[model samples]
Target: MQHFPTGQAEHKRHRRLARRNANGIYNWIMTNDVFYRKVLAHLKHDYSKLEQHARELEQANVALEQDNVDLRNALLAKEQQTAELQREIEAQTKASGACTRRWPARRNQVWSDGWNRLTNELAEAEATKYREKSKTRRRKIKALKNRVRTAVATSNSFEQWLLFVEQEKQDVETLLARYKKKLQAQNRIMTEARVLARELRRSAESTIFNSSTTVNSWCSTFERGIAHVIVAGELFSTSPATSDGSSCLRSDSELIYGMSTLEGLETARRGSPFSRSS
Candidate 1:
């Protein structure tokens, strides 16, 4: 077990160890180069994948922004429409309120006979105008319908039918437009009529106020004349007159002054010409 090696055997063993060490160094270098290449490749692949993901995210963000813009526009449009509808609702409500509140007062309240007659006349005029307008529209519609029927019945070919169809469409559109225009005009006229009625009411009230003021002024003047007459009567009673015996009698002007409103009273009793006109 303790025997030493010979020179030849020891030489071979040393040579084999030196060759194995050289091969190990070469193998280590090659393996390290391969590992480095694999690591570099993985790094590049990961970078490429990350870049692709970032681009996809950017595209998705762009699409989301576009969608958001469209949604905002739609929301704005809806808000605008809501505003318009609200305004229309307010206007319609006001119109209805006005129509309901004032239309009956003209009939119930008492004013000048002229005002009553004017209200009646305006109402009659409106009714007649509306009746005539409705009749005219209906007549025109009937005539148009008859014409369309005639055209349809007389058509002999497809071309003729097509022509008639086009004409019918045009006629229908024209009728619709006419109806629309008439309805618009009717609403406008109704609004104008309400305004006119309100104006008339105001004017009537003004007239009554002015009449009352005039009546007050006339009463003041009459009262002053009466005072003066009483003073004159006292003076006449205290003074000595000639033998004419005219002190007990009033003059025509005095009598007329005392009853200054007799004619108006009689006229009121007889009914005014204005009330009679209705």
Candidate 2:
């Protein structure tokens, strides 16, 4: 029993030393845990700030995309408008060129037509003048032929006719003077004839004559002869009178008187002196 009490005292002293060392180790572990917790909280705050910046950048990118789409649409519209304007300008230019090309041709055509019409009118006028001149020349030729035929008829032979024609040229001048006096006489006769005709017409209207055959016949014969002489004088003024002046003598009594008087005049003309006038 004495040995057992000594062993218990030593064991109690060793247990006290081991307990103090364990207390020191526990204090060091607690301090290290507190430091680690503080470091982790700081890292978490940095990560949150990075996340917020990323979200803002995504919103800005979306806005930029929308603005790019609007700009592309505006550019397309402007290009379409420019193309339309260019086409319109080209069409107008072509039309103007075509008009310019046709103008001179149209003007020339009008001028040519006018010139042709004027030329035709001038030609027609010239032709008309030529035709009129030809008609006048034909009339003159016919008159000259009648004069030549009358000259030939008044002579006995061709040689005599030439000589007679030359002599008749002087006689014609004298005949022209005589013709003027004859014309005055004819005018007086015509006046007398007209008065006689008027008296006859009035008598015919007033008197109902049952036997007017002889008177009517004589009147017709006298008028017809007078008209014939007048017409012959007008047509052949240069021709010699008939041998006994038969063309001038109208009634039977006048024919006898004219023949006697013309024969006396011819005898006198032949018997007159052949002295030349100065």
1-278 in candidate 1: lDDT tens per residue?
12224533644555566567886655555554665566667667877887898899999999989999999999999999999999999998999899788767754664666787999999999999999999999999999999988776766566787887888677667656655654554455445434433443444445455655534444443444344445434433433222333333433543453343333333332332333335
Candidate 1 segments exceeding 4 Å error: 1-32, 99-278
Q: Give per-residue lDDT, candidate 2, residue 224.
A: 49
The most accurate candidate by TM-score is: 1
Return the TM-score for candidate 1, rounded to 2 decimals: 0.26
Per-candidate TM-scores read: 0.26, 0.23
> lDDT by residue for model 2 over 154-204, one digit each (tens)?
545777878777777766666666667656655555555555445444434
List per-candidate RMSD values in Å.
Answer: 51.1, 27.7
What lDDT does the true structure give each of the candidates? 0.59, 0.56
